[model samples]
Target: MTALRTGVTALAVLLAIVLQAALLPHVGWRGVVPNLCLLVVVAGALTRGAHFGVVLGFCAGLALDLAPPADHLAGRWALALMAVGLVAGLVRRDERPTIPVVLVTAAVASFVGASVFGLLGVVTGDPGVAVTDVLLAVVAGVAGDLIVAPLVLLPLMVLLTRFEPQRRLA
Candidate 1:
């Protein structure tokens, strides 16, 4: 079951990355693409725990950093998404969260992820990020993530929920 869950998780992350790379860029809102990969990590953390979220975040971010069309330094996103996972996981509860809670969490995660990525770029002396309107990008990215979160999170939550340990009826 663990192996199966791991395999499914890997496939899901890979699919998210593929979609993020291919479909999302073309349909971006206000020059910011929705981050399906970050959503996946959030779902994992919400369903599983912080540890899983952190690991998945790192792996997914690394893939995004290395994916084709990537023109920025590697590890920036890895660190950023890892931070997202950590924050989301810290906010997770044993029971399911309400819609508002989930949305707020997604917004926070989106903000943190984008901010960290942009900050890392600035720290690393990336010329593109130095001049980009980071505040606008962050706002747009958060809005985009919020807009797409329900669509992405619902299915992902269903898939990830299967990985939870079954409750024993006493």
Candidate 2:
């Protein structure tokens, strides 16, 4: 049953990634795109735990790393997302998960992820992005993720509740 739950969660994350990479980029406001993948990763970490979160985070980061228009090192996202997942998982409690929590967590994770990526770019001597640009990108990404987090979280919660009996019971 745990295996099944893990499988389902992984599948859901994959689908979310595909949608995020393929569709959500086109649905932007003032050039700010939603980080649906970040939201899903946070949700998974909140629902599961650190171990699961780290594993899933690596996978999600790998997908993002391999995505087109990639600029940073392959393992940069993996490290950043691993940290995000670990933090989220550690913070999550057994209490009822709320929209605010999910949104805030996702937003923060998005910031951290972007910051890590930006720092990596700077370290790697990517001249295109300035320090201010990295900060602005983080801010924009957080705002965008917060705005669209609930949209992804609600459906993800529903799917988790429906598919994972453990979550339903919780």
RMSD of each: 1.8, 2.5
Q: What local distance difference test score does each model get?
A: 0.87, 0.76
Query: Mind giving the per-residue lDDT tens digits that candidate 2 earns over 1-170?
Result: 77777788778767766777678777876666776666777777777767877887888888777777665678877777877788777775868668777767777788887798788888888879799998888898888888777777767767665554453454
Write down the TM-score of every candidate. Answer: 0.93, 0.84
How does model 1 fare in lDDT?
0.87
Q: For every model in order, what is the number of clashing pairs? A: 0, 0
lDDT (tens digit, per residue) of candidate 1 on 1-170: 88888888888889988998789888997557999999998888777878988998999899889988887888989999999999999884756788888889989999999999988888888877653577778889899999999999878888888877787745
lDDT measured at residue 79 in model 2 versus the true structure, 0 to 100:
76
Candidate 1 ranges with C-alpha deviation above 4 Å: 92-94, 168-170
Best by TM-score: 1
